[model samples]
Target: MKTHKEYLDLMLDGLENTKDKTPNSFSYDVLSAAGILFVEFARRFEELARKFDVDNLEGFELEKRVFQITGLKRKQATYARGLIKITGTVGTVIDEGKIFQTELGEEFRTLERAVIGDKGEIDVKVEALRIGPFGDVDKNTIKISKDYIKGIESVTNPADFTNGYGQESDDDLRERYYSYLQDPPKAGNPAHYRLWAEEVDGVGYAKVYRTWKGPSTVKVVIIDIERKGASSDLVEKVRKHIMEEAPIHWENLTVVSAKEKPIDVAGKIEVRNGYSKSEVIENIKEKITAYLAEVAFKKSYVSFAKVAHAILESEGLVDFDDLRINGTYDNIDLADEEVAVLGQVKLD
Candidate 1:
């Protein structure tokens, strides 16, 4: 897995190694030319390798070909949502797709047609045109596109706009492709429900349980891409998808978001003499976060031993004392619909 830069450095080292001992004619110009040639060739080789798989492909080619073969494509950019106040008479119409921009030039549009209110104040919502985490913006940052709308006093988000997600990553698409190939999604089986649940957008993980409520009852619990509880909208989307795909004879199906169970961590950390205690603590947090991500949807009990090991082995940490998860220093079990998330880490 050597990167292009690393390979280029190796080639340059070989050239230096071959410099004549007696003549010593390794001029800077010759070395610079060699470096440029190595870089050019390495980049071309990298491009050739990218063509080998859907995971490596990018841009339009990925959308047109690789994604088509895998049965999954990149997610398009999503819109940020917020409320806009319009001061106008009831007859006023805000057309769907009317554009707006933030002070930063991020564009947004109304989700649908809206009419003004009789009280001279109407609440309308808009979504950003561009996709990504950028769509999850703070309140009061949007202004109506000047030419289109008049008497627009101000825009404010009543709640956090967090539905925005970036295009699917190569790793994510690869997982879905492999899962589809492995199970191939047929009705009346747990695997079929799991596969269908995962196919929904924004779902990072899914698990299916038969007889969860009673005989002939199926429960599908899901976590979103951020490893948090799936939104109600997402839950409904999954439910509808399952309802349509499930066989007519199948029993009742319930799709629910995983409930978050926060766990607090407390410990006394000792860092080596040359290392900062804050840096060590931060590293411990990162390791714990990564551990949680890996075990979020599949396992019921998080390994307390693994968490202790992560903190003890952090790069700058010399040792830790009395490290406890929720004050017990033991593995905790979560119900089928519950997920564990880090809450607070107190280090002395």
Candidate 2:
């Protein structure tokens, strides 16, 4: 017998294997499983946001919030949008506040639910504002720090990292990140629930790596196919395949949208290298987490340099390779100046 977690992993693995064996592309089941895997990823990410005190950190003093709109976005009039019911929660978050949310939005696509929190046991629940046909979700939660509570001021900017969520040390950031990613928080959404958030307030949505592509060439190929009618879920699978099949130059396949447009691509087809259907998806979980963590890494490094530098200032040294980051942060050792430097240094 398999546990619910095991069940999903098995399904995901099987689908990956199928993609390897099949030369054509992903099947309905594979596509469905991939989609479901992303949903689970979002659920887990939301869980991580809370665990990391993503809404607010004790070291750097950065906080954020997650919101959900229960109602649909319909046109009250030709030029106006009627947001039926508005909902969601704002709390402290540890990862890249603006960027991380955007990536999460792309991955989930179906705003199921979102939560915000700072610290302590209490996390506030905000309804998810979404686009269409969302699943049923019962409740959500959020938590934040006392000083960082002002993050919810106007949304978007939320809690500025400059203020500090109480997380002052790189060690603090690292520990919080590690704890959040490694140990997930408890989730209680119904099985039928699936979600997609309304982005910030209006223009854009929360962000995270939507999918991992092998290289520019492959991505170009994928964009063409996606525009032709292939699903982003399936397209992403194919992108992953290209990575395994073509170990080197997989990066060549990566290509980004010029304007973040859904798709209007046209390109050459026929990938020379791609994984067979027999190959299994290695680190599907890792892939998603890594993407989020890396995104957080970039933002955090930029935002918290002053504090990140302090750790190294004591030691007068810094090294990129030695940095240790858990899901939530690039951890620095408080006692050892060198260790602190490790987290302070940026990796190539």
Tell me the number of clashing residue pairs for each predicted model.
Answer: 2, 83
TM-score of each: 0.66, 0.16
lDDT of 2 by residue, 78-119 (tens): 111111111234443322222112213411111223234433
Q: Which clashing pairs does model 1 show?
A: 77-131, 80-128
- Expressed as tens digits, the lDDT of each residue in 149-242 for candidate 1 is 6545444455556667556665666666767777766656888888778777777788889887878889999987767787676788789988
In order, the Cα lDDT scores of the candidates are 0.73, 0.27
Per-residue lDDT, model 2, residue 243, is 49
By TM-score, the best candidate is 1
lDDT of 1 at 70: 54
Superposition error at 211 for model 2 (Å): 23
